[model samples]
Target chain A: MAVHHKILGVATLLYLLVFFIHVLYFSLKKERVLAVAWMIIYATICVHTLGIVLRWIESYRMGVGHVPLANFYESLIFFAWSVTFILVVMRKKISYPVITMCASLASLFLMGYASISPSVEKNIQPLIPALQSNWLHVHVVTCFIAYAAFVISFICGSLYFVEWKGVIPPKAVLEDINYRSVIVGFYMLSAGILTGAVWAHYAWGSYWSWDPKETWSLITWIIYALFLHARMVRGWREKRIALISIIGFISVVFTYFGVNFILSGLHSYAT
Target chain B: MTLCTLRRLLSFVKEKKTIRLPDEDRLSRMDFHSYVPGKGLGETVGILTKHYRLAVNGEQGAVLERGKLSRYGVFIIHTSIIVILAGSFTGLLFGYRGFVTLKVGETKDRLTLRGKTAAEIPLGFALTCKDFRVNFYPTGEPKDYVSTVEIIENGKVVLGKEIRVNDPLSYKGIRFYQSNYGSAPVFFFNVGGEKIILTEREVFRKNDLLMMVARFEGKVHDFGPGVLVAYLDNGEPKAAWFLKSVDRLREQKLQGVKVSLVDIQEQPYTGLEVSRDPGVFIVWAGFALMLLGLYVNFFLQHRRIYLLRVSEGLLVAGMASRNREDFKKEFEKLTEEINGRTS
Candidate 1:
């Protein structure tokens, strides 16, 4: 019932609207409908950003006084925001409404899960001693950006093989976007892992402890690394490269959610 | 030899070698030996290579052009992985991690190593825990665990700091992190005419009655501060609370023995994780090199164009390490520029 939650709820509804409008744009082939969807997305993002900032202010009011990147619910919100933000930024380069709809659906799912999940704690809580550091902001921001890039790439890569019958862009365009997003994701993931290591060293006196979360992150990194090597060095294309991109996103998902939910480790705090 | 065979064989000869035939023709007949471009090349190619920061090499019969950025990027990235592994390996070999628990006002110069076999190592300097304080939120979740510690060397107080989670104390290349904390409760007991003292986790035995001070509780059912005492009866452990604020339980009789609580005090002990990793900086260096290498590899392209003398004027073939489609367009534009300049 807080202001920020209401704002986010409104944003979520707008996102659903955006998805429907995208569908309309595709079915009717109306550029006006597509333009309307873009306009709604921009407003949705603004409201979404306001909600995030307001939640940060709410945490301060609650005396926690930390960034909103502390818990599972907050992370989901940030993930949704990052996905939409990245999609909009890359809108000019990738003007495919179908991709936008895929992204919108992804963000809706994240926001919906954050709001509807019974396990997620929505209240602002004080950080544990270990997470009370500046590195949390750096590490979480970079990792989510990387995840957003991968999400976009997953959309493009999946559409490449679908039999859309002229509804989708050329395979070359999708492939290029996939490749570019993977490159961005790879670099951000590397930075995220590095920052995590540095923060761990400061807090626990060990940089690399084969914790499940850390191991899964390394696995994700390796998968992406393989993707890059196969595409860039081995000159793989089309289905093979698309398959690797999808697989890499799967690893990313496992690292982000599976490790937090199923495995017990130092990152159990995330759960 | 064919281009693929030559490329595979040349992989062993040069670290940064690229050979591809975008469109193969009689131009492939030109005998080509891949040179590690930066190492050996013609002065003309070398000058252009340095000026453009591109990779250009002179083979036996043709001149090959490629962006040196990708080559060096691959080289740097691969080498950085080796460097990181080596750094961590060095840490594993040379570094030591140990733990020490210091009660307030206690000093220790040795720590027990963390591994299968417990071994103690000298810390070179003694560290004393001045105080251990833990702050908690109203929700009872701990917000901070801080230990005020001081380092002493040969009767001199050298360094002092308050170490907390994510904020550690470093002295002589060894870091001390505030890893954990526990309460060290002290209890004084008077049984009949004998007086005894016990602290947290300490066992006291007299006449087959085994007692241990388990922990100190702030409020036990609103009876005020008390100590939880565990007693072994018939080899089964049973715990009972002894309240300092209550007169009846303060001097309770157990097993025909008069056991009276005299006074109790609770102090906190700080648990510090100690480590000295000399290779951490090397690992950081590897991280820096890797970021640099990745930037080049992702954002830059490696283009290799081969020129051969032909019956009409000249023959040109081109390829790229990655982004082949984009390179096709670039190659076309470049060849047009070449023809325009010559015409």
Candidate 2:
């Protein structure tokens, strides 16, 4: 198997273990072991990154000569890598082990899709004429980074909601952390769209084409826009805004992977 | 004697009716009516009615406004829509998109059209592909396609550049792009009663009255390509309309001219897209403004912290903002830093 495949397998197994441990910890109320679980998640993420870089090198050997973001398998791996990377960054300010589970779960889902999904082919392919550009690296990496950040905020937002409505128990610290994560995510998302627009204009003749990918991206941006408006203009409570953030992140997921797999248009290259 | 005869001939040719008359008056009046105000007003009104509006206001007064009316959240949405429309229109009206496919030595006069139809035509000058090359991966997937092209005007090459997918060539308000690739049939021509057997190495001029002959090169022994002939007659040109496979010549006669399609060659060519946009700078500026707006909206949270001195050393501080938790945390951190610095 390829290095990427090995890393993916490892990441998947680790993520599943982490998920099981999270459930067991939550049920058994073993909060102290949560830190150890987070460390395990972080280590798996590092391994995933190493695997991606190695895969990139492997593509160069195969003469593809582009980043590992050309197709569904590579993109899924990238998505997992980005989500984990962002989660690690947020951990410093958040100081909570619970959110690590979200990253682990997302990684697990990506690995599962890569492993079992017949539609997703795990082989290095050639770059199309349209994708044969240096912008491929800059455009794709930045967008996924921003997406990862959004995923983090979304996870935190779910926690905020559960706590806010007394469904899980209100924790002010957790809610505040979730709100901050969303703010960071929104900023990165804005940057990602801008970068993508610039890349589109450079690659294609137009900046925005109302293609399904572009439309859904705008839709994702709009959801976040509404989240911002609710936070700033409407003076929304953190709990409600967090719930909206979760909803917004779900839309982001749909926009990133769902748009590629389910919907077809200019972004079909991603699929 | 020569002068007198010349003067007589000039005088006879000069007539008042031929110089100016009733017909000229009517034609001038028609031109004037075409430019009259009433005719254009209806068109202007039609355009005015198509404009949309967006507005936003609190109970007291308007906060944001644009277009026809004001509504909350309309500012961002409408601006975004306008931005999108403006970008799209700029792309459609001024944006040029076409592809150029050239074999190893073959050159093309025009790029192939892509995207919307109306946006594909070249606004000014013609682009000719001088060269095209494709680098392939070991697994048979294409790595890159590069096209070398020149902008020609009045039979002279004005500019020359090589363009790739990300790195497009732009000169004098036009851009050339390396877009796609495919295998095109190369043909040989025989003209002027001489067998001019040219392979993939010869370059042919457009609308030239030249006979052609083509053949298959590789050992694949497959059915080959066809030959096309374009001829110029009395300052007007006509193209031969027929497709002949390899080893098969189609003979046709047009306007008493004998034409035959010889052979066809299959050669790989690169496709290039061309475009020209005058409003691209404005669109880029709009993107910058949008990014600025988002940055300000996200990073800069409006918070005011006021401090009032009580008696002696006691002081009370208050904050008026929506993000009370963030404000409180920042306030505490600031006060701690200040105390540490003062102490």
Candidate 3:
């Protein structure tokens, strides 16, 4: 087994454990114990980061020598890392145990899928000619960060619709979070799309080919565009905004996965 | 598609309503806070107006610079999107993409479109394929595909280029991309001590010996570029095969004729994808606009603090477009200064 996989597997288990512990502590009226849970989640994120770095080093040792972000397994691990990093950084401001649990669950799910799925190859391999560009870093990092922001916004919106149900923060705070996180997501998605377009033009002859992935990305953007525009509507309020956030996140998931697995396009190799 | 995007923009416009603070009653609702040293309502408004870069109209006021910057951000962002959409529209109106296949030394005046209902579009000038070559990696993978081409206008050379993937040749606003490559077989035969070389699909006949190459393969039992050729032996058709490699040429003699490949004369055909997009610049400019607008819109928050004369000390209230917590700190500072001043 790879070193990163072993570490990340342990990290995934601990993430779930921390998530459960946070929920249990919150339920039992022991709010301070959730601090311990928070620390453990932070430490888990550190371990995850180290595991990714070690995998990068391992790839270098194997002469592949590229960032651990080129394939399904690698990108999923990155997805997990991004979620954990963002959630941990947001721990202070948002400070909701439910949010942390959801984030940890998301990371754990991704790591678990990456490890267990037969379709995902965990081995480090040389990048093909098409991926050998500086834009790989720009495109993937911006994209994953945007994805993580959407995940955060989705969690906030989901919790809001349920009225937080003994969650730490007030409903207004969650609504604020839902709005701010989506703005961050919108900006990052724009940056990601622009960078991806630049990269596409660099590798392929065309910038926007309406490939399934690109088309899905555009659809996701339009959904979010509607979400942003809905904020400007005179009578539309928080609940409607939260609903749009939920819908926009669903579009995000479909754009990221459905376009890869179900639809045939130029980005099939990315899957 | 254009109509769809245009409708989105139209709805965006319909969604926004102009906000303004124009009177004392509106000022009351704004939760005006902070007290400045002044004579009365008129003097207090003067001090407040002096401190803030405001556009005051009939007691309703807005901060000038921040409001302008925020509005500029909104303008730039929306305009950039519209410009991008318009650029795509112009591209669809004027741009056409098609591919041209050329054999070595073959001059083609038009490119073939690839689709269900494809058509040949003329370039108005001839393009000649001078050379085609490929560089290989150590693992025998193709590192680069290069095609040397020359443009011929009115039987005169205008431009010569060696194009590669991502590095296309542009002439008269049309781009020629090196998209693909291949080779055809060329056969050299020595029949009765007479030497002659013939390209694929070209018939060679001398005194009842009519010969033509059927096809060329890179490997026929690892023979390396085996040329399949057919000959009319006294008008009775017969077929023979020979390798392009010189070492393997003597190994297979086709019925008293020493046939060898002149390296199979690998007439590599360069697949040049030609396109002309006139609105590409508008699209690029739109991207530039988006970068600037996004930075302003996301990073810069418009913070406002309205001051209204009240029965007690001036009631302080504040609002920011984003980061209300950070704005709270600044709002406190403003109120502290106003509270300390002599009113």
Candidate 4:
């Protein structure tokens, strides 16, 4: 087995452990277990970061030197990494245990699917000429960061609709997180779309091809824009905004996965 | 689609009417920014004012430029959307995308437009394909495709360039991109002391005999480049491989006829996508503006702090257009500093 795979497998196991510990913390309300879970999360993130870096180095060793942001497996790994990394960074700000639990669970889902799915290709592949541009770095990074933010927002928004049993943050805090994450996500998604357009212009000689991926990204952007306008300008609160947030995240998932698998376009290499 | 979005944004901004400052009571005195002596004191202060400056009515302190220019961020974003739409509109009206295929040592002066209207258009100057090359990785994946081309204007070579996937050759606002390539192999053969030339999938015919090139293979059993030839022997179809190596070609007999493979020339054709969009720079400019606008809109806010001279000491009140929670914390910190300095 690959060194990176082994390290990432350890990280994945630790993530599962973190989820169980979070569930325990919710029921028992023990600070010690929560602290242990946070420490484990920190350690898992470090190991996860190492695994990603090692995969990049292994690609270079294979003589096909390129960043790990080139295929489905790498993308899934990076997506999970971005979610956990962001959650850790924002852990102090969003101190609610449920938020952490949900965010970690989301990352775990991505990591699990990436590792166990037969459809996902784990081998490092050579970069195609179209993907050989430097814009790919900015495009994929910004897009994934935006997706991670939306994931956080989706968790908060879904929590807003649920009746919590114990130790959950107030509805106001949940709504605030939903709003703030959408703002961060909106900016990053805009940057991602613009960078993608620039790269496409260089490679295909057309900035806007109305390809399925491009069209779906635009649709996702419009949905988020609607969410922002309704929240900020229209002074929308609680249920409506939360629903928009959930729907916006659905659009995001469709853009990222559905477009790649169900439809064909310039971004077919991602599949 | 862009136009419709622009319309919606314009109406949204217009419907909001203008920027509003929060009304707070318990502050008696006002400053030079359009203060009215009524229930709504300081209502017009900083209202519809594009410039921001410190105004002291009874006391003077410090003046800070708290990103007042950021208020224009919305304007900048709206105009950027318009500029982007206009740029794309210009491209739609004037720009054209076409494709031209040129074999090595071939020149063409026309291109066929690629779209619903598939029409031929003149290139104004002839483009000649001098050479074509492709490189592959050890895994047999294509690394790059390059096409060497020269521009011929009035029978004179003006410019020569090598075009690749991301690197295009441009002249007179028109660009040529290396889009694709294909093998166009030429083979020379001698049959019964007569020389004949053939290419892949070409048929050579003589009296009562016919031969056709079936396919060209880069390798056959680790031997070098070879060709598969199909011929008719008394109306019976038979196929055989012809190797480039002289020893391997010498052993091959074509249905009782002594045919020898003389030479093989592998000439590939380069597929070039030609395009000219005059509004590309405008579109880039719009992108820059959009990024700047978004940064300002997300990071900066319009804030106001009013210090009124009362009978006791001073009354301080603040207002912010966005992120009220953060602005409130900042307002508290600033007020604390003022109290510390004054007392």
Residue-level lDDT of model 3, residues B1-343, one tens digit each, is 3465466567557745544544445555653344343424444455455445554333423332243355356667877888888887887789877899888888899988767769998998999999988776554655567789999999999999988765778888788877777765456666656777677777876665677887777788865667788887766888877665646553345555555554455456778888777877788788888878877877787766554445554444556776767777776776665555553
Q: Between 1 and 4, whose lDDT is larger?
A: 1
Q: What is the lDDT of residue B316 in candidate 2?
A: 20
1 or 3, greater by lDDT: 1
Model 2 residue B268 lDDT score: 69
Q: Is the docking of candidate 4 incorrect, acceptable, medium or high quality?
A: medium
By summed lDDT, the worst window of 10 consecutive residues in model 4 chain B runs over B32-41
Q: After superposition, how far is residue A115 of candidate 2 from its true place, in Å?
A: 3.0
Best by TM-score: 4
Off by over 4 Å in 2: A61-65, A92-97, A156-178, A238-243, B1-123, B153-155, B183-258, B265-270, B303-310, B314-323, B337-343
True contacts kept of each: 0.90, 0.60, 0.15, 0.44
> Candidate 2's residue-wise lDDT over B1-343, tens digit each?
2454355446546732342112223433421111111122223223222321112212211111122111112333335445655766776786555655556555445455666563334336666666777777666766667777777787788888777777777777666666677775565444433344354434443343433322333333344334445445554755554455533345565444545555555666766556667777766666665555555544544443222222232122333223565557655664454344334
Docking class of 3: incorrect
Best by DockQ: 1
Q: What lDDT is reached at residue A139 by model 2?
A: 70
Tell me how large the interface RMSD of candidate 2 is: 2.2
Question: Model 4: which residue pairs collide?
Answer: none
lDDT head-to-head 2 vs 3, winner: 3
Output the lDDT of residue A21, model 1: 95
Which regions in candidate 3 have their CA more than 4 angstroms from the true location?
Answer: B1-25, B36-67, B101-110, B115-172, B176-178, B181-270, B306-329, B337-343
lDDT by residue (tens digit), candidate 4, A1-271: 8999999999889889889999999888998988998898899899999999999999899998999999889999999998988888778667688888888898899999999999999888898877888898999999999999999999988998899668668998999888878878988898999999988887898889999989999999999988977876799999999999999999999999999899998889998
Tens digits of per-residue lDDT for model 3 on A1-271?
A: 8897788888888878887897788678686788788889878988888889999999778756778888878889998888887887666666777788888889989988988899888877666556666788888898898899899999988887674356647877888787778877888888888888877765565678998888888888888878877775444556888888899899989888888889988777678
Name the runs in model 1 displaced over 4 angstroms. B1-67, B138-140, B187-264, B303-320, B324-343
Candidates' interface RMSDs, in order? Answer: 0.6, 2.2, 2.7, 0.9
RMSD to the hidden true structure, all candidates: 7.2, 21.0, 6.3, 7.7
